[model samples]
Target: MSQFLSAIIPNEKYYEKSAFEQENQKVFQESWYYIGLTSSLAEKNDFITTDIGGKSVVIQNIKGVIKAFHNVCTHRFNKIKTERAGNGSLTCPYHGWSYNQDGIPFGIPLKKEFQGLDKESLQTLCLPEFKVDFCGKFVFVNVSNSEVSLEEFLGESAIKLKEISIMIGRKIEYHEIPNKANWKIVVENTLEGYHITNVHPTTFFKQGFTLKSEVDFEVQGQHTNMTLHLAESHKDDKKRAKFHKLLANRPFQPEGFFHQLVFPNLSIGSLFGITVYIGSIKSVSPDESVFAYELYETNLGEGELLSDAISEVVKFSSIEFTRTTLAEDKEICENVQKGMEQSNATKGVLNSSEIRIWEFQKSYMNLINK
Candidate 1:
């Protein structure tokens, strides 16, 4: 059978405010969002804040435990920690109310001034907390308090996710790119290798990356994943050998390159199981989104860090290559968004090579339509 598919989602769905609202409530809000790495919060009171579907969340490491809560202050609803990432006690700068790891207000400055305030009332004024879970050191926050756990949400993909996380070390690059495109447009761009020949000719194509024909797709529950190995032509390339030799003594070596999308918005990709990229696609509006990513190298165990020369090469190669690739994607996705509202067509067509995109669209439609 010819493997072609029609885009299940309509063009209007890509640029409509109503559709964005529905997806925010039903899809992103109800799902677990990959926020940041646990390596970033290595010490007590270390916290990273993020906004998911208009709700702000803060993940903190308190006394060796990772806790997540709404970033809002209970007294005035102002965001307790406005900064993106920091290390500090969970104290509201607005009114000097400090919360414990459980988010209950333990210190209310000038408590006697407030009339009718009691210990029970103080206990009830706890900061609303969300469910926090992890696979390896990758932290995920669920806002809806859904019955489904992170492992349940990830399904079989959890194995790959955890494997990738274990292979990786601390973050080396953190970037937040404002995309002038619908969040889905940004996401769908990452789902397929069909655009590699055109959109990433230099950044990806010239780098020995395989195109759609060589890509393998697998559907894991609502998630879609693709794996790519070295093309025959580049198998013996000297640069590839040098790159591989840099981590020849690592505990875990990557078999191939893989990209995985965890349902609604989280994307994880890795270069030979090392140099992993984790991104969360956050919806800002109907036609706007933020693509924030963190890049990490393979873990080399304690005191076994690569030499400065090797580390510099790794950092430079990881940053320059990924930055260029993402820049190309941002431009293309933005251009697509501009035409989305002007297109006369109802839906675009899909090919066998683009099966992952179709799988993603189906998962999206199933959730948004529910």
Candidate 2:
């Protein structure tokens, strides 16, 4: 990585409505996004709904196969499933128009009232379906109906993502936070640890998770990965050592903290694969975005499981730490967005430690400009 790299994206692009729309169509819609784990939709009729780019999508388990469809009814065009997730058939509350597993509208109340509406006509009214794929337990949805496969979109980083998903045992927490910042601003913040000391002083900084700490970066195609090496002092921390001792018999364990970005959005990280998190941002408008996250703990068999008391303590600590860190980041990102409105700066310089941010901007420019 170069010691210094100039920012490619203009500052104004961060809060411009035009830029946001273009990004919604070009970068987000055309690309794949990590929604949630496949396990979340394991049972029949189980579904998870999300907004990708500007499109609303619902992924559901029909019988045994997982399917993706537009979360809207054909009659009134109302959202079929409004909640983030639930277990129910794709039935629209507006007019009781229920869709089949394949998104075909099979049930419509007062059907005889409509004229020239045949069986094939019902197919036309089928909820528009999108592409869905999985990398291990991780589920991704592409709203554009693009020809690009998820594997192709993920490229070489797909293996690492699959590995991360395999390590997840159960979800501990999931949050969808609204931020007063552009989607790009929120994403760019995660690409660098430069603000760790200032923005996350008490949490990340105190834990020695600063850019000055030992770290490794890999810019793979459209994605990037950064691994933060554990400090000698932290390696010998009494609490961590005790936890390790409890799970020593496990065949596999999470050992390090690594953050991975799967292009446009989707940030996945883990502390020794023992606790994992996946976060992503979606643009609500030019100056607003929604941050969604899912936190998980490593899956361990009965023999390797930690005591409930010990696990609860670890879980509580992890949740509190992450919640605090996210709250800090949220305030700073919004501040940055506010500052962009007053700054006339054209280009920003990045240090070698922020190469991941530079790479992210490069990818963004390539897609946005194309």
Candidate 3:
């Protein structure tokens, strides 16, 4: 029989060693984790060091390739790269073990100590690598080699991401934030519209966007997307009347409107010309988590007026809205975590509105439990 989780599950942390915990490290870690924005490392040799699943990692654009590696020194296992990002051949300060963009070990300061080592052997000693792929300027890395392609994993999201990327072209920026809730809660926040009509009533209703307590879900593999289609009476609409000013500045609204999510919680959402990314995020445990996000779109024009308008109006709206909502979500998730912690006897229930969250939990439970 197919597993059907009832009220007892949602009230419980899926990571807890209870009836709902996930068994797949291949599901969370060791898979494609959204790493960085391609714009962040546009030129060759441009690199970044970011933490994932508690381990530090480094990424670089070599020639035309983007590569990811554990930031630990192969010799002492010390974190190899110290800076968050920069341009250079990577060197481990711990033992002077150094590498190039290809993750090829290049220089070892004291080769005399290990005299028998050949160039190929030293070259092989660089940081280990994960698979990398991109949609637009965003970069994704699979920590463990996966048979599934990133495009296939994205499903319909790939289309939307491609559309947004076309509108924005190659010019954009990335801003990342780490939150204090389980990564799953962050995913839950993005997957539904229920919170918008309530918790975000001020933000949305004020802008004249009518939200619903309901949501819609579509699933593929472990990836699923829940879209919130805002309506005319939304509160954000009036405040966004200025958005109409773009009518004079630009010819028409950009071609697409859609929400994209690949399960275990990586999401990209788009409306008008703004495309928002809630990047690859993972839960450290039942309570703690971190996330990276970027708000970007194409530059509207060449001069000060266009740049100011793009940065101030569109960019500000997208970034500030996500910042506010995520803040609200973190608070709610912390409380949810606490509530779940105290209530071990009963399972939580999901109405149709929460189907996406349920879908996510079921898939996660399946992967982790097996």
lDDT of 1 by residue, 1-370 (tens): 3578889999998888899888888888888888788788889999999987788889999888899999999898988999999899999999889999889988988988989789788778898889988887678889995799888888898887777766776567889899989998999999887788788777667767766337778899889888776667776789777877778776455456678998888888887755788998889999999999888777665426666777777788889888999999999999999888898999998888888888888988898878
Q: Which candidate leads in lDDT? A: 1
Better model by TM-score, 2 or 3? Answer: 2
In the range 1-370, model 3's lDDT, one tens digit per residue, is: 2344353235456446432224235465655666666777888878887665455678887776777888887777887778768887677887778777667677777787886688777766767887778876567776665687788766666655655554553223455556656566677767666566567655654443444422456676666665444563443555445654553343114323345576655676655444445465656666666666666554444311345655565666666766776677777777776766787556676656666667777776665555
lDDT of 3 at 195: 64
Q: Which stretches of candidate 1 lie over 4 Å from their true place?
A: 210-213, 251-256, 301-303
Alpha carbon lDDT at 20, candidate 1: 84
What is the lDDT of every predicted structure here? 0.83, 0.82, 0.62
Query: Candidate 1 has which clashing residue pairs, if any?
Result: none
TM-score ranking, high to low: 1, 2, 3
Instruction: Choose the strongest candidate by TM-score.
Output: 1
Per model, state how many residue pairs clash: 0, 2, 26
Per-candidate TM-scores read: 0.94, 0.94, 0.81
Off by over 4 Å in 2: 232-235, 249-255, 301-305
| Residue-level lDDT tens digits of model 2 in 1-370 | 6689999889888888788888888998889888888879899999998877778889999888889988878787888898889898878988888888788888888899999889988888887888889988788888885788988888899888877765666568888789999988888888777778788878776765665567789989999988876655566678767777765654335355678899888888776666778888778998999888888766565434556776786689889888898899899999989988888787688998888988999999998878
TM-score of 3: 0.81
